[model samples]
Target: MTSALDIVFAALADPTRREILRMLLEDDMAVTDVAEPFAMSLAAISKHLAILAAAGLISQEKRGRVKWCKLEPDALRAASVWMQSFGQFEPVNLDAFEAFLAQELHLPTDPEL
Candidate 1:
């Protein structure tokens, strides 16, 4: 049987859902606003949102007539803890990972990079 963590990992596996999480990181947004940047239909975005909601990555509430989506940052704690367990094998150096990402993306390295 699939666990909640399994569901969350599945939801986060999608690039669109990951982007949605990033957008919500800044602030809550109306469903329409969340759908704006994507090329797909609102229905498609809603499907992605539903997956995220099920994963506990986000929560949706209706206020007035608008349905808003908010990021539940704490929801990631489980995943974070699971990832930390892997640290027993090797330490996670975020700075080095960031530099690696920059190199792979062909972005310039700097104090901010």
Candidate 2:
């Protein structure tokens, strides 16, 4: 069976949905307002919102005539925790890692070097 984390990760796979989450980080917004910056039609934005809502990444409610969307970050706790598990490893510097790789492969460096 699919877990809730599975759904959350799936929903976040889209760049548009990721941007929507970032927008909500500031404050809740009217559904139309959330759709404003995107080139897609309101219906398309609504579809993305639905996927986010289903993933528990966001919650929506109607205030008067306007439907507002809010970020539900609690849904991300599991994913965050899972990622933090990898924190035990030392952070690697890319330049050092690349040099190590070149040395291991006996690859020639630039003539200027």
Candidate 3:
């Protein structure tokens, strides 16, 4: 059985899937609009979307007719946490860096962050 981490890595491996995520980042989009930036067929893009959805990177919802896709930001958090496990041997404090950025920007630390 494929682990969730494996699913995430596999989903992200495809350039097309990454671009699809980029498109979804701005707003939820129909499959056809998501496929517009690439030369691939709608079917191919649909397949890519399936991979992404399976990995929990995106979720699909149907409203009446067209299906729209939206990015699951929490899924990226899961992926980052998985990858960070490998870097446990390192000394860098990513949280501290994030706080430093927050301080420099004069923004309060994110509660969810």
Between candidates 2 and 3, name the one with more favorable TM-score. Answer: 2
- Estimated TM-score for each candidate: 0.81, 0.74, 0.74
Query: What RMSD, rounded to one decimal, does every model reach?
Result: 3.4, 9.0, 8.0
Write candidate 3's Cα lDDT for 1-113 as tens digits.
Answer: 87888899888887788778877889999998999988979999999999999999999999989998999978877778877878763436787778756754467776786
Worst 10 residues of 1 by lDDT: 100-109
- Residue 55's lDDT in candidate 2: 93
Q: Which runs of model 2 end up more than 4 angstroms from their true locations?
A: 88-113
Maximum-TM-score candidate: 1
Worst 10 residues of 2 by lDDT: 88-97
Q: Provide the lDDT at 7 for model 1.
A: 89
